[model samples]
Target: MMLLALALLQAAATPSDAATEARYERCIDLATTNPVAARSEAGKWQLANGGWFAHQCLGMAYATEGGWSAAAVEFEAAARAAEVAKDKRAAQYWAQAGNAWLAGGANDKASAALNSALSAGTLTGLQLGEAHLDRARVLYATGDLDGARRDLDAALAVVPEDPLAWLLSATLARRAGDLPRARKDIAEAESRTKEAPEVQLEKGNIAAASGDEAGARAAWGIAAVGKGAAAESATRALAQFYAK
Candidate 1:
């Protein structure tokens, strides 16, 4: 997942920072339409003592190009700079760094950055919820199922409307043999939306676990026709069923 960029430049509070804010906005504006140029601009700005915002702009530019590793590096630098400046947005920067690190396939680094963000005690509401959710992904990937479950629960508590959190909670509940909890969460997910392939796949998993073979097959079949990682997973699930 990509980090949500702050709209800091959208409303500058003082004239002294107007020029810097305009430059930051320009860098962000180019990230979508001309990321290469944005990167070049950010590099120049950084060399000109543009400080943390320059690194942040560079990170956004790299993220636009799917250069995850470079984005992570820049985001981490920005986070550190934000912290040193005693900026309230430091937690958000750390969270963004964590997300970029995860995108770069650095789970350990992601986990550490996420920890820093959470420990900052500054993130609130959905932002904090999302941080917990990403940390859960890292924990799950590291085989720390218990830790993942705790984080997922925390995420759901803060963002009950998040279908992904419910789906993951259901999947983990099922794996832990808490069928009742799993069914409840999966039903909640189903009520929210049925368009996601992963949701369909989880629906199938719950059905299969409950010995409802036909229901499982139906859901998985729908999911298998979709694209991306979820569809690939659904395909593997269907193959396993047929092989049995």
Candidate 2:
């Protein structure tokens, strides 16, 4: 173990200061359309000892491919490397690790990793908001409705403009039988953003929860603006929900 540690320590890293800048160039190129390739490319730096940057670039790559498992590994590695390097802002990597774990089907582990991330510091308001969003998603998936709601509310309190936070909050509100809150949040999101098919999808979700098929259809039509995969899924959900 000591030998491996030494090797990890001595390994010719890709240089911390420059790794992020370089990886971002690669990430933007591959992630826009070729996610799988992007992931494989990003994974190359895992053993390079580049700290949080390598992990972040790689995390985006895996997220693009929906390969949460791989993303979790990279993010976890980044967190450890950052901690060892005493990078005070390493909390972001830890948060990414937790999010990846949650996305990868490791619930308890995700929470634990996130706690480690939070230990780093309160970080910026945006970072705190993201932490709450991640925790809420994990808890909601684990069937902890109350916990999810708490996190969502905290996230909204910090950064209400965060689309994902609003969408998740609205979902949880609908689940908690707070249709008015759900509709309000969804409407607020729609009013604030013209892009992001997800905003429309969540609005459709709100309509479906209210059993308003026409409303749901109208919301989905707005979502189909980009005619992307997200839009298709929203259309499919509306179809299925309204068919009943």
Candidate 3:
């Protein structure tokens, strides 16, 4: 499961001066209608202003077309520009760069950007939680389970209501053989978001761990109807269950 926080970041990464906001709004509109032309316009704006917002617009244009690597480059440029200007928004730009890097599956680069974001000491509340969660993902990918778990704990403390945080926490707890914590965490995630296939899949796994075959079957059946990887996983689980 992934954090939904990126959409919020994308909405307000730039400074909120009226003129800049107007330009950013136009950039958004044009990005939806014509991404190529939006990139062109943003490129010209960058040449003229060379401000963080210009790079933000360029990132937005690239992101519209699923160009994650290009988007990460533009967001890193925005971050560097923000740093040069001593803007507090540098943290957010770096976080956005991390998100783009994560989307591109460049976990090492994502970790670097996220580290810069956290080191900025400007993020608070859900933004801080998101950064921690992203770092946890990188740590988990790199087999640093203890570090990943610590970050997930930090993320949950900051954003307890986030279903994705709970889901990942549950997964990590289960992997570490903390079945009770896994069960509790997945229950919390289920309460926050009932339709999440990852939650359901985890619930099934937790039930299986507890030797509750019926519970496992029920949860997996529900999860199998979902779209994407979770559904495929649930289907495989059910097939394996019936095979035995």
- The candidate maximizing lDDT is 3
Query: What lDDT score goes with residue 4 in model 1?
Result: 25
- Top candidate when judged by TM-score against the true structure: 3
Instruction: State residue 120's C-alpha deviation in candidate 1, in Å.
Output: 0.6
TM-score to true structure, per model: 0.88, 0.67, 0.92
lDDT of 1 by residue, 138-179 (tens): 898898999999999898889888777888889888999888
Compared with the true structure, what per-residue lDDT tens digits does model 3 show for residues 93-164?
888888888878999999999999999999988788888998888898889999999999999999898888
Q: What lDDT does model 3 reach?
A: 0.85
Give the TM-score ranking, best first: 3, 1, 2
Better by TM-score, candidate 3 or 2: 3
Supply the global lDDT for candidate 1: 0.81
Candidate 1 runs further than 4 Å off: 1-16, 240-244
